[model samples]
Target: MKTQVVIIGAGPAGLLLGQLLYRAGIDNIILERQSGDYVLGRIRAGVLEQVTMDLLHQAGVDTRAHDEGLPHEGIELLFKDARHRIDLHGLTGGKQVTVYGQTEVTRDLMAARAAEGLTTIYTAAPVSLHDFDTAKPTVRYQKDGATHEIACDFIAGCDGYHGISRASVPGDALHLYEKVYPFGWLGVLADVPPVSHELIYANTSRGFALCSMRSEHRSRYYLQVASDQKVENWSDESFWNELRLRLDPEACERLVTGPSLEKSIAPLRSFVAEPMRFGSLFLAGDAAHIVPPTGAKGLNLATADVGFLSRALEIHYREGSQSALDRYSELCLRRVWKAERFSWWFTSLMHRFPENGEFGQKIQEAELDYLVNSRAASTSLAENYVGLPLESF
Candidate 1:
């Protein structure tokens, strides 16, 4: 098969790029290894930055999101049994964060794609990159045990970490920067509704706990755990007990415990690939970088990258010039770094570090207290969480 552009992976980045190209009347094909159901079901980041919401609104997919999504003015911080609420709206001149899961975003994107009746290949595992450096890049894949070849003018390697496209680039051709944290997060979803009206990020001597929810009836939460933790080790009682410790007395008991719907421990990581391009093949989203879930910035990062690159591709096609395409890597790296720094700041502030020196821990706590009470400090966070850097636009 042939196309003007072949996007690898049907996740947010690839899917959004495809939709954008569709709107621009540029034909493209997306090949995803996972089934559509799995892709749409995998629970991930929920916080949608202001810029992300703007993109969705402009794309005509925000109607359902706006109707069902949870709009949060700001987040609460819990420490030493005291709660501090930061007014994100007041700080950032009305910027807000939307609590819509990554899975929901994928669900919306899938529905949008199906409604459009565009052709896409799911369960197509990419095996190799063919002629990636040439004008025409080919993706060799096996779908249903049958080998197939997809050729295109340019390939958007939106496939995530552990994807073939990232590895296909020779080691010497790319510079990899990686930071793996000492601990991971044990995320849980309960059928019971959230105990509080706002999200609470708590730092406790035991560990860190995050309080989030999907809807009025479903609560999503997390606990800090060992990086090598196995799901079988954490029981319902322990999960609730940890939640009890991190939460304040006022809201802790009201946190009605319910059946655990989802459970997994994701390792904390901060990674960025420099110059996310190799000839005509460019990396996007997780393929190019990863921000810890601390700031709920992963999906936003992908949306920002695809939004920028998609427009760049449109310009290249309309003007028959490659300047935008040539600058794609640099363009994406700027936002990627901004998100990376913010995620790091949020995580470092809220999560307990076992190896932290006494002064380091005190500094973090002091900074958190100041930020929560000071409009200037909260505004700094509000701006970053609202979206990637505005200067990029």
Candidate 2:
């Protein structure tokens, strides 16, 4: 089959890109290594920065989100038994974040694609890319035990970090920057009211804990754990007990415990693959960069990456100009690096490193103290958290 573009992976990045392209009258096909059920079943963050919400609206998937998603003007940082709220909206000139799950975003995009009859192949096995460096690119994958080939003008590697998109690039063509933290986040999703109306990020003597929610009745919480920690080792009761210890007294008193619906451990890491474009092939979202979840930048970053990519491709097709297409990598990397810096800094500030010992702990406390007290520091945090303007570099 022949198409204008071939997208690898049906995750948010790939799916969002397909929707954008379809709306622009551009023909594209998506190849997923897993079924639609598997993609929707994966649990992910709910925080939506301003730009992400705008992109969702642009893609015609914001109706449900606007009606049901909770908006928070600020986030609270709990340290030294005190809660300090950073006024994100006030600090960022009226920008705020929405508590809308990534799963919901993907589902909405999928529904739109289905209604429009856009082509997407689920459970496409052994997907591979070829001739990306040439004018004509091709994608091959197995479907129902049969091999199929698709020739396209360009290839979008939106699969993910471990997907073939990044791996297909030769070593000399890609420069990787990465940092894997010594700890991981053990997250639990439960059917209970959240501890607070706004999200709380706590830095306590026990560890780092974040109290977030998917809705009024569904809570998602995370605690810092050893990099090798096993989820099987902690029961629902034990997870709640540990979480309570890290929270302030009021939050502990207000917390409602319930059975966990999902539990998992995710390692913290920041990674960026340079030169997001190679010939006719382009890398977007996690395929090009990954930010630690501390700043809740992963999904938002992906949205921005694909937004830039779609615009670039749109310009190429509509205006017959390759300027935007050629500048895609440079523009995306500029924003990617800023997000990586914020995520790394936020992770380091909130989490306790074993090697840092008491000295590092004291410094972290000092940093948090300064952040909450200084207008400049808090504004910086608020701006980055709500998201820097998509086009601002």
Candidate 3:
């Protein structure tokens, strides 16, 4: 097979990148190692910052996203069994977040692609690259245990955190930066409704617990846990009991239990591969950078990356130039680092320190108190949560 662009992974970054290029009158191929059904069922982030929503609208795929998704004006910070709401619009002037699952967005994009007649080769694993030094670059893959080749003008390595594309690139040419936090998240997708109108990020001595969503009838919640903690070790009874203690209190009715849909543990870390482009290959999303889920910024960051890369692809194919292509890395990193900082700050703020003395806990409490009361602090959180502008490549 041959095309102008080839995308790997079929996650948000890869699928959306393919759609944008298709709209630009450029043909592309997406090779994924997983089935479409599996991709759709994977539980992940749902909060969409205003900036990401705008890009989806611009890409013409936001029709269903706008209709089916819920619009949230702000988030609530609950601590010491008390609730405090931050009016994001009031704080940031006009920005608001939309509550839409990652899986839903992927399903919408995949459906739109089908309507527009874009084909993806699912269960296709890349074998190797043929050329990047010539006028055409190529990707060779094995699909259904058979070998195949895709000739392309460039490659978008959208395969996520543990994928091979980022590692296959030469180490000398790549600069790797990483931060591994002391904690991980025990994320649960339960058949329970959210306990509050807005997401509540609470910091208790128990650890950091974020009350979020997968849908109205379903709630996605997470609690900080030991990095080695396994989901199988956490029983249904224990999970509910923990939820009741840390999340449910006398101020609010206890969280109602629903069937446990899924549970998994993911490490919290920040990583970025500098200069996201090498030859005809470029990295986006988790393959390029990862932020702790505390701030709910990973999906938003990937959407932003594809937004920039798709525009650059448009220019490269339209103007017949390499200038824009050469700058992909520098451009995406600007926003990537900013998000990393925010995610780290949020994680540090909500998680307790093993070395904390009485003063450290007091300081954290003071900070949380200020975040709810101070306009400047709240606005900073609102601006980052609602979204930051995408950089142009």
Candidate 4:
């Protein structure tokens, strides 16, 4: 089989890229190692930036999102037993975020692809890329006891961190930078009204806690725990009890507890692989970088990456110029680094670090005080939180 572009993985990044390319009249095929149900089963963050929303509109999958997604103009921060509100809309001149689950986004993209009769092969395993360094690149995969080869002009590596896309790069060619944090987030999804109308981020003596929701009734909450923490050890009652201790009195009173629909513990880490382009193979989303989720930038970053990539590919096909394609890495890295800094800073400010001791606690408090009171500092936070603009090619 031959196509213009072969996209690996059927996650949001891969599916969204396929949709954009299809609209641009580019022939592309998506290969996924898992079934469609498995992809939607994986729970992820929901916060969506304006830029992401606009991209969805461009892809023609914004109908459901616009009808069901909840919009928030501000977030409340808890410190010193007091709750402070950051007007994200006001601080950023009417910019706001929407609470929409990543799963829903993937579902919308997948449905759009199916309606258009796009080519997406699921359960295509043992995939490999060859000759990416030269002009002609080909992808090989095994399915139904048979090996299939796809000759393509380019390959997109959206299979995520552990996938073969990044692994295919020679160690010497890829510069990897990573920092594993000392704590992890124990998250729970329950079908109950949220603790508040808007999300609340708490910095307390116990630990850091965030109260977020996918909709008005589906609440997603998180608590900072030791890196070695086990999900099986915490019962539903215990989890709620612990969460109450970390919240302010008012929030605790308003909090509603219920059976958890899903529970998991994920370690925090910041990782980036430099120069996202490896010859004809390009990496987007988790294949390129990862942020701790403190700033809710994980999915947003992936959207930005593919947005730039799709535009670059469009220019390459339409204008017959390689300038945008060559500049893809440079443009993506500039924004990727800024998001890394923001996630790192937000994680450091909210979590309790035993290694930092009392000094760290005092310093965090001082900074929180300044951040809430000073308009300049709050504006900076709002700007980064809403997300930095995509650079023009």
List TM-score per model, in order.
0.96, 0.99, 0.96, 0.99
Query: Could you tell me how far off, in angstroms, the CA of residue 87 lies in candidate 2 after the best superposition?
Result: 0.5
Leading candidate by TM-score: 4
Candidate 2, RMSD to the unseen true structure: 1.0
The runs of at least 3 residues in candidate 2 whose Cα sits more than 4 Å from the true structure, single-residue gaps closed, are none
Q: Pick the candidate with the highest lDDT.
A: 4
User: Candidate 3 residues 1-393, lDDT tens each?
Assistant: 889888888988898888888888989988888899989988888899877888788668898778878888888877777778889888888778889999989998898788887879888865576566466888898976788888888888898987877877878988889999877888888887887768888888777788888667888888888887888999877776676767647424757776678888888998888878878888899998999888889999998888888888899889987787778788888899999999889888888676786677678889999999898999898888888877655
Q: What C-alpha root-mean-square deviation, in Å, does candidate 4 show against the real structure?
A: 0.6
- Stretch of 10 with least lDDT, candidate 3: 245-254
Counted clashes in each candidate structure? 0, 0, 0, 0
Superior by lDDT: candidate 1 or candidate 2? 2
Q: At residue 277, what lDDT does model 4 achieve?
A: 98
**Quality of model 3 by C-alpha lDDT:** 0.83
Q: Model 3, 187: alpha-carbon shift in Å?
A: 1.7
Lowest summed-lDDT stretch of 10 residues in model 4? 354-363
